[model samples]
Target chain A: MTSHPHPAPTEAGALPGSLLIRNLRKEYRAGQPVLKDISLAVEGRGITAIIGPSGTGKSTLIRCINRLVDPTSGEIWFGGSDLARLRGRSLRMARRRIGMVFQEYNLVERLSVIENVLCGRLGYVPAWRAFLRRFPDSDVERAFALLDAVGLGADFATRRADQLSGGQRQRVGIARAVMQDPALVLADEPTSSLDPKTSVEIMELMAALSAGGGTPIVINIHNVDLARRFAQRVIGMSRGEVVFDGPPDALEDRHLTDIYGGEGWLS
Target chain B: MSEAALSGPSRRWVRFTPVERGARALVYVLTAVAVIWSLRTIEIIPEFLYDAPEQTADLFVRMWPFDWAFYPKAVHAALIETLHTATLGTLLALVLAIPFSFLAARNFTRSGPLNWIAQFVFVSSRSVNSLIWALLFVAIFGPGPLAGTLAIAFRSIGFVGKLFGEALEEAQQGPIEALTAAGAPRSMILVKGYWPQVEPAFWSVALLRWDINIRESAVLGLVGAGGIGVALDAALNNLYWDQVGLILAVIFAVVIATEFVTSFIRSRIL
Candidate 1:
């Protein structure tokens, strides 16, 4: 295990999961680009939040990094491979190293929480083993540990996923993502479906867990206050373009107005 | 009511337009004409119609004393054979239909040709009745329980496969997306994501088809495919109304018993 207890190197050093995206463009329809040209680099550690109005391509940008929503044209360099170009087995290998959390918890509702968390190890284990639910003992132990780390105790492990409330389900979601032992974790509006108090709690839990594991997070978030509070670095976006990229302190009301458009709601 | 009174131009609301009313009246007239035409065309002999009640009474009188002694000699073995045929056929249908169901489900297999082929198989299998299937199988397998079992199985594939495929198609996309993002292989996604969602529906559909297959296979023996229907056919040919009445009663009791058993199992399992 290369995971260190200390914080990752701050400088643009060779941290294992440092992502460098170059001129990424995506178009779902011919000549109608959803993401016009995006370029940014994320550090290997710390929470980097991308804030934007709905439909401004925050999801497109985050999904592009893992090649989930494939970029029409661009290069995403991470761990010595272009993620946009990888296909089949190689693509799966790259994806297994990056964990993602969704706005909806997205748990297999019929499965037990422990089994859902063990799904993270699917890419690493053989298909037959997974089919039989005969995961390695160490993987099972780690899954339990991750559930505990995500604020769910061992008692919750055997319960069906659908039995949990929204907050509890997201906790299971986070545990599942963390169970992958990812180098980078991407969260696409991870707290939108949550109530305000639970959203803050989830962000806090995510911040604590990822920081301790030295795993970097690139989260697409709509709640600007939550973003500023938890994100070390914030990238503000408008019309599929990044308008501001800096420390959270540098994100003034004017920048929020520019990113979200209009000062009507700022009051 | 106040708003309408204030408006003063109270309009009426009609359910159907003039054209729609005309169309409905035309449908009624056509249906009446069709009934009259069929009644006029049907060639019913007046003498047979007049004696129908007496003939029915005479038939019942002949069948008054059922051949209960036949149960130990023949009906019991035939009844057991019928059940085995139904059970084995249902199991076989489940085994064969599962793969076709996967192929037919649009979400599971994305290829158009595969879906079309699976649907084609289902349609052809369902179009032919089980008795016809028994006839075809009896010719191939030469008069036995094997023919009866195969007949039931072949007839059930379409019903079981179509429903199972629809169940697989209805699985939520959210869980599937999560598994895919986790870098799970396609096979793993099917096993972990889709299978859990569809398991209950699979069993429910299998049980339902099995229940229907029991009724179908009971009559397959009339085609020389082997079941209680063989005894029924022999009694009818030999003009033994009492034995025929006994077989019918036994079949009725067994059908009711199976219905209870399947419903109980379904409730418990689901």
Candidate 2:
């Protein structure tokens, strides 16, 4: 853990997708900070898991990266721009390079699966084109191919998103993020609502896809074991602060106790 | 100590406080008094009351011999005009209310003054009855289907806009957030996110409003705007009770038919 509160000029420009969060702070209410001065460096490639107890601001931290939840004061350096200060058109253009997945698989329930997957290209395509569902042929093909890669075949493409099972929906969600051709993907509790088996499958699928595309992924996950299994690096958080940052092997039982603050559930 | 406490006395749970119980009793008394006082003030004539059934029977007797001949010349055309007015008015209301609904929807627009203006329009439209709207439009447009259509459209704007706005507000933010995070513009997010979620609700509201407009439009002709009500009004003025009865029957049938059609369509859409 370098703990560099500032992004070194040399490393900042070194990678296309590398993220440098410097002294990030968020206060929903005056004098009450939910995220207090968080700083982290995520490399341009591979999976980085953020594991913490509920309400510890792991989701907030990941959201701040993509400007989903604005940081009160900080600098998020990505794609050679300050993601923190980006506004309006610039912000939207910057967001085109960062994709996101949600725990609920947040697809438009009434929309067809293919369209849901194609939604990732909404930023690149004109509004009227998206409205008319006249996505470019290349994007359509990429969407279908991503669907297949996520294990949803051509048969599932025409079906409504709501018709799919939890695992199937998550697959579509992953396909959508991949369809963005993003340099970075942020997943907020991507497997929190799934069953244990499905959760493991989703994690494996995410790992393989990110590795295949070399798109760096930062996941906010509650499952420590999944993080340890799938992530190259794990950052442990407690009470809105990063308490541990290292390889998964370095995350010891004592560290878990410190992160979650209870020994009863450790066993 | 625990055994003694358990055996001592059972606690009582009262549903309401003494003040609340007294208030409820007072409300009942006030309602009864208001009903009695209103009844006493609007005195019914004893002679008219005694002749009411006889008069009704005589009126029915006069209306009995049906006006089948009048259907082709007047009733049919007026009926068609009424339907056209209702359909057109409903369409116009839908088109106008859609933008207003988006404006009023807190989640969609996020502007306080715009929401207030939209809400004010809805309130003003709803406050004036369709008949009153017909009267106003009749003054400006001078008594025709156009006035009737305008009245129906104006009255329905509030009903459609308020309900559709609520539906837009109720749409889950998750999908919208997902679209926003995907770097989609505001319009794209609306197209992909809000539109899909609100489509069914929009259809349901539109159909319900159209059904109501049919009934309202039928009566607009009484105010000299063109519909079946105008025919009925003419029949009433000329002492043509039979034509009036026929028109009433037609209105009743059309209203019931529209109710069935709207409900069926609503069930399918929902």
Candidate 3:
């Protein structure tokens, strides 16, 4: 059964949660590909920020891993299965292990904050249990703890999600993602709508919390400064292709200009 | 404070284009000519305006005050029956509409053929008038409260179903996406995500439909389906103007009472 050269069993790629994307492509409309043969790998730990200018396919690349935006052609290997080819039940199960946080903090407005946190458990809980809202005691306790960890007090449990400010909502968003105990996390422009201070605070919280459990997070970030600050590894994309992939220290002005294009804004 | 010095407009600017002026003149002339022609075609008699006041006065003289004695004999029971018919009918429609609406809502019901069938059912139910439905049901069930109840339910299905489908369609996609990413099954998505979003609309639509059903049921008895209209029809047939007046007054009171009650419920629930 062993066909390829062995890279020692202890190699990072042998780990169950390792994410490897190969030749991924997405064409929202025919003849106009948004993700063009992008390939990368993460060893399934720590934060890796994908930075690019607007409309440079950063969000699309993140979404494709979750199968939220279907990849036109490629292989997304994670958790011992090809994510791109999954359908229905298989797709949902895979998505469960890959948590996502949206830019807008898409909490169900009518739901209480605790319920929104419990939403991350829907994949594990039975349909009837979810409908009855009879979450397991452990999941409920975990959800409460997660709320506290995200800086919302346990008293905020019963409050409606819409009652929170932008920063608080993003905290809940992170809490919701981590509540899944996910193998990997994807955050699409997680701080684009946030103020400068709040943006850094969220990035810090995301890095600390996600790294605590050794869950790898792939965030689509527009702010290059925050990416440089929090990300251990950085990916720079331009015109649907990865132009730079290296550690944060190696990301130079030349790369920024190459990724973002002739930036007078860099001044 | 300087009213005399202020003016409406200056003559230097041309307002309406010549083409617009011609089009407006054509519209005005055509509308006036059409109204006059329609009056002639319908054989309108201006003389009725002269005699209308006397006829109305004489009719009022005949109707005079309420027929207090007749209220107990026929009006009260019929009014109660009308209320029962509407309540039961609206409940039945709601039960049927919930599943039917899921089928008709395009975003939920992905199959083209199934959606077509659901839409056809809604259209067919809505196309027929409640009175016509009453007439059909009366022919089948033999002129009773059952006919009136069935008539009201069948007629309301389209209205409630269409509104419900629209409400589901217009639900915020973001929460639903969140649920989907959480691995919620389709039914859980409906109960937790979609239902909460459309709950206010559902309540409002149901109450409004119930209010409409009440009015429809009252007059359904004209086609031999039992209601307040039956008592009024009988009195009219017998040339008893006072009893007819009494029944009309009861229907009016009942309608106004229900309007107040439904509006109160809507306010509280929504």
Best by lDDT: 2
Candidate with best DockQ: 2
Candidate 2: true interface contacts recovered: 0.84
**Candidate 3 wrongly placed segments (more than 4 Å):** A1-13, B1-21, B45-49, B111-113
**B198-261: candidate 3 lDDT, tens digit per residue:** 9899999999999999999989888899989899889889878888778888888889999999
TM-score between model 2 and native: 0.97
**2 or 3, greater by DockQ:** 2
Q: Which one is best on TM-score?
A: 2
Model 1 clash pairs are none
Docking class of 3: medium
TM-score of chain A of 3: 0.94
Model 3, residue B129: distance off in Å is 1.4
lDDT of 2 by residue, B1-270 (tens): 698888878889999999999999999999999999999899988999999999999999988887978889899999999999999999999999999999999999999999999999999999999999999999999999999999999999999999999999999999999999999999899889999999999999999899999999999998999999899899999999998888988899999999999988888778
TM-scores for all predictions: 0.93, 0.97, 0.92
lDDT of 3 by residue, A96-174 (tens): 8888898998888889999999988888888888888899999999999999998899999999998999999999988
Candidates in order have lDDT scores of 0.91, 0.92, 0.88
Q: Model 2: which residue pairs collide?
A: none
Q: List the candidate 2 regions with Cα displacement exceeding 4 Å.
A: A1-13, B1-6
Across all models, the iRMS values in order are: 0.8, 0.6, 1.1
Deviation of model 3 at B132, angstroms: 0.9
